[model samples]
Target: MKEKVLILGGTEFVGKLLVETLISDQSKELYLFNRGKTNPHLFPNINKIIGDRETDDIQKIQAHKWDYIIDFSSYYPASLQRTLDHVNRDLKKYIYISTISVYDFNKYDRASSIKEDFPIVDCSPEEAIDQTMKTYGKKKAACEAVLKESSWLNSVILRPSIIFGIDDPTDRFYYWLRKIKKETKAIVPNDGTDQISLTYANDLVAIILKGISGDIQNGAYNCITHDSISFNELLETIKKSTDSNCEFYHKDNEELRAQEVFLPLNFISNLYYNNDKIKEATNLSFTTYENAITAMVDHFEKEEWKKCMIEIDDEKLIS
Candidate 1:
């Protein structure tokens, strides 16, 4: 009999990619659970359980046990604890998709290089939900705390950088790609010297699947590319990839931030990760920044990236 793997929030962006990777394994039984929306027809033959996670329709999940559970859709820390409480303790591994934003980006006084053991969000919300601030990252951080405190199954927490791909809806890099598509010149923020990291969905999926079958890291790992590409380097790659003869007009960070358009452009100077431990543990080569960006551009061209963008008017699906 083949081993079994379950993925929560399986029909979404990262969950969809992870399902594809696991299905190719052939030695494992794959299962995906979601609200039966967004590409529900994509995996017709696969086992899919439908229910709303926000509510308590967890009966479908309780019926089965999996060798591994990879969560990609969880945003609330309490929700994660609920799922773990329902799962079997003998499970192989539990992989959580987290964000590098857990690190206090505002705390610039700390060292440039942060390890997996670095601090993360652990605060309670004051008033209205602030997803833009510590709400999302801090919720994820609190989820990590739950896993660490558990003794039954091994857990792997992955903090990925900005993720972009063909079906990407984040608009993280797509914003720039769209801009470059229209004009020959674009305005960049803040001297364009800050280093920003990019994590390709394919590369991240690869590592997550490999981790499930291999030894457990039993902790958090920063899932970013090996190289640190600057804002200028990113632009150049786009120019070279698209063969566009575009010129870059620059603006200061303060200006962009004041406009609120530059909030996502959170540049972490010296934003490189120590992947030696991950590489040695998994025996996998980290994806290069150039290759990662190239993949995004390739996917963008194929999808006509402009059509899939989530408009500001339909603000609900902005993630």
Candidate 2:
């Protein structure tokens, strides 16, 4: 019998890729639950359930038992709790796509890399409702807590760092790519020495499939590239991929902040993570940053160049 797979909020970004990956396998039955506000007609042959997780509409998801339920869009603790309450007993395994932001930088101060066991930001139930970027990490940590504490569910939490690929709405990674491709001069942060972690959306899909096949052990795994890259290296890779002669000028973080300009991939704290646990458990090979950049640049050049073009103001960089 084919395995029943239910994906919550599988209409965009990583969720969309996950849906596509699962549907490619004829041995798995795919079901998507979302608000249906995005690309609702993309997969006409598969099952689509329309409902809002924040409202009473979410009850539409509890009708059937699933072998695996991958949650791609549960950021708020309340919303996650509601979903868990409904599906805890009905699903055999739960996979939550979390972020490395959940790790508390302050607690791990002076540490070069973060592990799954690193301390996460502490937030109360009251504070988790804000849902802003400032509180995003704390909120995700809370959601992870909810899943772990649930008695009826066996869960796998994947903490990815800066997920990027085609159809990404955030434009965080694309911002630098576009800047390098269009401009001769680009402003970088902190002399471009800060280390950063990134994950290709397709690689994340592969890891999730491995988890579904019971090849990856259950627990929280830092889902990112096996190796982290410095910000300067990242810019060089983008420059090479775009084949652009972009000269990068390193500006102090304070200066950039004073100008009200924040560079993407430049984090306030070191964003490196140790992927030894995941590598040992899954033995999966991740895409190199250079290769991932080449893929992203190619995709943008072919399709997203026109639709997702971003204008960088030189005056803002100078001010």
Global lDDT of each candidate:
0.71, 0.82
Q: What is the lDDT of candidate 1?
A: 0.71
lDDT, model 2: 0.82
| Candidate 1 Cα outliers beyond 4 Å, as residue runs | 105-112, 125-134, 263-272, 308-319
Q: What RMSD, rounded to one decimal, does every model reach? A: 4.6, 1.9
Residue 40 lDDT, candidate 2, scale 0-100: 78
Least well predicted 10-residue stretch by lDDT in candidate 1? 310-319
lDDT of 2 by residue, 1-319 (tens): 9988988888889889888778889889999988889887788999988888888777777787788988988889988988877773756689999998888887776656778888888878777899578888899999999988887778999998888888688788888888889888888888788877788898998888888887775689998864777888889989988999988887898977877776665664466688888888778888888888898888888875754344557545755
Among these predictions, the greatest lDDT belongs to 2
lDDT of 1 by residue, 51-122 (tens): 877678655788887788888877766677778878887888999888887776565444556667666656
Best by TM-score: 2
